[model samples]
Target: MFNNIFLLMRQELALSVLVFLLLFIKIGKERSNTSILNFVNIALFVNLIIGICFVGKGELFSGMFATNALIILEKNILNLAVLIISMQSFAWLKNHDQVIEFYLLIFTSLLGMFFLISSGNLLIFYLGLEMSTIPLAAAANFDLSKRKSSEAAMKLILSSAFSSGILLMGISFLYGTSGTLTFSILTAHISNNPLQLFAFILLVSGFAFKIAAVPFHLWTADVYEGAPIAVTSFLSVVSKAAVLFTFVSVLYKVFQPIASTWYLILILLAVVTILIGNLFAIRQDNFKRFLAFSSIAQVGFILIGISGSSVAGSASLIYFILIYVFSNLAAFGVVSLVSALTGKENISDYKGFYKTNPLLSWVLTIALFSLAGVPPTAGFFGKLFLMMAGAAKGNYGLITFAALNMVISFYYYLRVVKAIFMEENEAPIEKLGIPLVSKMAMYICVAGILITGLASMIYDYIYSLSFGL
Candidate 1:
């Protein structure tokens, strides 16, 4: 039993140890934040490498937790994301007083995400969800001197509590009807009855809130704008990736019985989410808020893939997320560096930025190009596969609509690019000193975006996992 637990939960176990190591370091001596950050980054990189090299598969705790090739890949994707984030946060962390607390919160949320991904039952899923969310709420308040930071934390807490209630109510309804919480059993028991559908809607609402889908996305912009850049990056990349991964499992596996019903629901939500997210994003002068809405639009694209209800759909979703991690983080890396150096976060502040900061300008341009789904970038391939997977359902109209929305997305994404290169500013941001670690992180993200797009084999490997499943 012990061996099974260790084998099945190696990722979670290792992360817990890393968290403890950080705790011990915090208590032992008063080290410089730079040293602590260096230590943490090394540990995180080690963790990512270990996860990739030592993948495991099985179930434990009477099937309450499970792990497979796909889940392992999902977890490793997150590991890489956290490592990149830790690297990118170097400038911010080295100057902050609460470096250990920041990392502790990050790893705790990551540990919860590990459990959340492995959960085999509703109870375990909800437990993991709360564990992941609470830490992030605290992290949002890390900028203690800012009133907006406190407001961000408060809104997060209240919204989380509300979403948790809705989710739990859905779980109760599901259990009441199905008499089981285990995913495998729930799959067989899911029926398209009124109460069951209602429960499913409530559950999806909770998920929508997490992913920042339209109408449920009110808290996202405020939180992203108010939280420090590090937290915002974590929220945009790591947090969304975890929820979307689990959501794929729940909808495609556990609720497979009511596919048609949920497919319609997903379609409706995806269209609205894309339209609203894009429209609002265009109006945002605040860079963080702009990215917030952009992320919401990205979620809509993810839904189009999920709606396909096939192995292709699952593969596309994961592949796109991998591309998304690189693309989004690359953008955020530039944002973090610029914001940390200049205390600037507005779109107007970036006008003529390329004159002084050409490297960062190009990096952000590439990242935004990828986000806009432009060709030759990995994001283009990601969205291509997504739309192709969605097309498998023979809904050409919906596919065309999605494609058109992609054009809408392109306009706003390029707006920033244009500001950087084309617009003139008398007082542009100065040529700032870019940290070595942050530059390294940016290079990795740029490589990921380029390599993933060019390498078809990566997507093939992911598809093989989905097919095997």
Candidate 2:
């Protein structure tokens, strides 16, 4: 038990210590904020390396903490999120006054995510979720100058609290039905009870709010528009991915016998999320809000895989998320660069942006095309695998609708590309030089999008490792 607790505490301790060290270093030197940001990146990278070395398929703390191949994939994806987020945050923080606290909050949130993904019990999972969320709400309000930022924080807090209430109630119901909160034991106990079915619905609803699935996504646009772009990117990628990982684990491990219930629920949610996301994105003028809707639509694609309820489904979902992290980060990274340079976040502000920053324009073009699921990019292949997973389970209607949704999504994604490359501007925008770290992050994301698409071996390895009941 001591050994398990020690291992569980090690990674988090490293992160906390690094954050404090950076804080002290910042206080002593009065150097450029970039220096502290660099330290944060180094800390996160080191943590990633340590996680790779120490974390593997095993149980800890009497099975309350666990790790496996799937969790390793999750950790790597999150590490990539941290790297991208840190780079983007640095771009914004360079000129901002209150920068150190931003890094501290980000590290705290990521620490919570790490725990969330590795949690073996519902109690730990909820605690981790709240820890991750509360700091993020604070980060949303970090930009004290903007009223929208405060509004976003308040909305997020209110919505999060509501979701927590629903989740707690559901957990109580689940406990009453199964008499245990441990996933392994719950799996054995949750056979065919109607109350268990209701509990599953409530649990999924809570996750739906976290992932910004349709019918529960009212707060996404406001929060994205109000928060800093870096915080928005972190919320979109890392936070959403953590919730989905937990959702997949619970569906496959504890609720496998109730596939029929979740399948219908997931399919309906997918259809609504895809159509509504595309339709709403069509009218959005704010760049962050546009991507918010886009992220929701992407979640719909992920749900198609989950609806299938197979090891293939889990593998497909993970692959899609990995691809999405790259493509979405690339998009947001470019947006962060452009927004920082122009101090503009509106779509119209990007008019004739190509004239000044052709490289960024092209990067945004590629990112948008990938989001639209254009061929030869990672997003295309991610959707392809999801469709295949759905078909494997004989979900013909769901796959067909997903294909149609992809077509609808293309329209809005291409609109952003057109705005970047085709639209002319009356006012000439100044070209801003890309920072080395930011440029490297963008190039890595673009390369990852392409490489993951072309690499069949990686897909095969992931498919083989998925949990099979």
Candidate 3:
């Protein structure tokens, strides 16, 4: 039984241990921020490796928790994302007074994500969701002296409370209708009943808030702009990826019986999210806020793949998210470094940026190109697969509209590139020194952006794991 628990819940167990280790360190004597950061990074790297090595399939705690290759893979993707974020955050973490506290908050959120992914019961799912979400508000408030940071935390708390209430109401409705919270049992109970459909809508609303889908995305730009860059990266990449994984799982599994109904709903949400995200992205000046909208647009694409509701859809969505982790984090890495050094977060601050910092400028360009879905980058192929999956249902008109939105995305994405390489600033921000750790993280992201798309086997592997989904 212990062995089963160890193997089935290895990812969550390992993360929990890491969290406790950090807590102990915090309880002990004072240490330099650098030492704590290094220790935390090394420990997290080991935890990530552990997550990859032990792959199994089974249920624990009477099916409240479960694990399989695909779930394990999902957790691994998140592990990799958080590690990269930590590496990229070196520039900021080395200086922050409460480095250990920062990491604790991140780990707490991550532990929640692991549980959320492994949850086989709605009770477990809701517990995990709250665990993951509550810590983020604290992380957002980490910049304790900044008014915007406080405001960001306040907004996040309010929004989170609002969403959690809606989610609980939906869960209550679901339990009342189905008489059980177990996913497998719940699926057998689901139908096109008006009350059930309404519950599902409310549930999707809670998820939409997490993924920052349009209508619920009003809080995103402000939160991203106000939070520290590193926190913003976590919110954008790691947090979104975890929720998306669970979102796909819940839709594909628990709600499979209502496929026809949710399919149409996803279509409407995808179109509106893409259109609104692209239009708003074009108008943003703050770089974090710009990427906030960009991430929203990316979620819109993920939704397209999810709407396919097939093995192909599952495979494509996972693959796209893997690519997205690298592409989005690369963009945030640059933002973190620059914002740390110059305290400038506006688009205009990058004018003539390439002339002074050619390498960093190119790195940012490649990342933006990937995000814009430009050719030869992983993002292009990622978007391509998502569209193909979405078209699996013969929704060509929807695909066409999405394709058009991609073009609109290009205008804004390239607008930044053009500023970097072409537009001139009279006094370009001086060539700033890039820290070795941060630069390493950037290189890793760039390689991922370039290699993941080009490597067919990666997608094939994901597709294989998704076979029985």
For model 1, the run of ten residues with the poorest summed lDDT: 460-469
Better of 1 and 2 by lDDT: 1
lDDT of each: 0.93, 0.85, 0.92
Query: What's each prediction's TM-score?
Result: 0.99, 0.96, 0.99
lDDT of 1: 0.93
Clashes of 2: 0
lDDT of candidate 1 at residue 198, scale 0 to 100: 96
Please provide, for model 1 over 159-214, each residue's C-alpha lDDT reduced to its tens digit, 9 standing for 90 to 100: 98999999999999999999999999888888889999999999999999999888
The RMSD of every model to the true structure, in order and in angstroms, is: 1.1, 1.7, 0.9
Q: How many backbone clashes does candidate 3 have?
A: 0
Off by over 4 Å in 3: 467-469
Can you tell me which runs of candidate 1 are displaced by over 4 Å? 467-469
Q: Candidates ranked by lDDT, best first?
A: 1, 3, 2
| RMSD, candidate 2, Å | 1.7
